[model samples]
Target: MRQLYLNQAALSARATTVIRDADNQSRYLLVGKWGLRADVLTVYLIDGSLEAEVKQESLGLLPRFRLLYHRQPVGHVSKTFGVIREVLFVRGLNWVIMGNLNSGRFRIFHGRELIANIAPVSADGQTIALEVDQPDHEALVVCLAAILDRWAKHQQRGLNPLKNRGWAPGLSSEVTPFITQEKNLDRRY
Candidate 1:
């Protein structure tokens, strides 16, 4: 397994951040661009080549996003409207994310194979630990992790007024927003 660390504080505070390995070696550069409705996160290899990119497609309770690898749409990651657990569907890759995702701690699987594990985010919400099973998937995993971290932070901010209430075609909140059991959970892409 390969261990990696991301500075959550840097990622949230700046436009660009550096991702490091267990030995503190610079592995990739993460750059985020905030958009009116959608945000984009791009990852670049240490040598200055593009690794991957995740772009947001929609907002509200069930956020949607698409992932690009080699500048091609590889798949999409979207939140499911679940009341008990926060579930995300990775369409193209067929990846499953389980465990405490709202807290930034979870295991990722490609079908039946475990591919990566993200340690519970630090108490200060400033660091994230990632253990990936394969070296080739390192960049992709890191990029995905960043999106997860961003969403987690958004959840932490608590947009109750807009999130708690649902807007439907009629004059009623009959369409309730999907609620996760955990309060501190958030996500982005």
Candidate 2:
């Protein structure tokens, strides 16, 4: 297990486990932070299952991104760049949201590669929304929606199906719905 810290505050004490999918070479993990706070900090691992050769380092970091739920502040999520608008793990893809403030473009990255980009939809001191390209772009969004839904359920009930090793229904179900929806949407166009 590995320890994760945020600003010297212990975020997660146990090392998050990363599971690999043999079919597509994708990696998955579950990460959460426990503390005396009103909100829970959680992140679903969506990519990079590769073992850490070093002692302990974050897989990625994002310098200037904020997470919002329905216009309310959720928490901060990071990527390798600096700050990320969002991070989605679906099937075998890791979708990372990046913004180019100077160009007014919002870009999505799969691993280290650029996958898509769209114009900025909205932004303020606290949050930013980017218009994702539809149909094809729906895959990432749907995956994130599924993750968020499951995460909310887990937080409320104190149970996470993804924590199970052999019969992880949360991960399977969360991914399947998004894939099916995205496929259907793709077939439509």
**Which has the greatest lDDT?**
1
Error of 2 at 78 (Å): 1.0
TM-score result, candidate 1: 0.76
lDDT of 2 by residue, 70-163 (tens): 3343333333334232343222344555543333344566677665553323242111122344433332332232223333333444444446
Estimate, for each residue in 29-143, the C-alpha lDDT of model 1 and write its tens digit: 9887643356788889999999888888987776788889879998898777644355565789888777665667878898889899987557876788889998777777877
Q: Which regions of candidate 1 fall more than 4 Å away from where they truly are?
A: 121-123, 159-189
Which number leads on TM-score? 1
Clashing pairs in 2: 2-15, 61-79, 61-80, 62-79, 62-82, 62-83, 63-82, 63-83, 64-83
Q: What's the C-alpha lDDT at position 17 in model 2?
A: 32
Cα lDDT of candidate 2 equals 0.34
Measured on C-alpha atoms, candidate 1 has an lDDT of 0.77
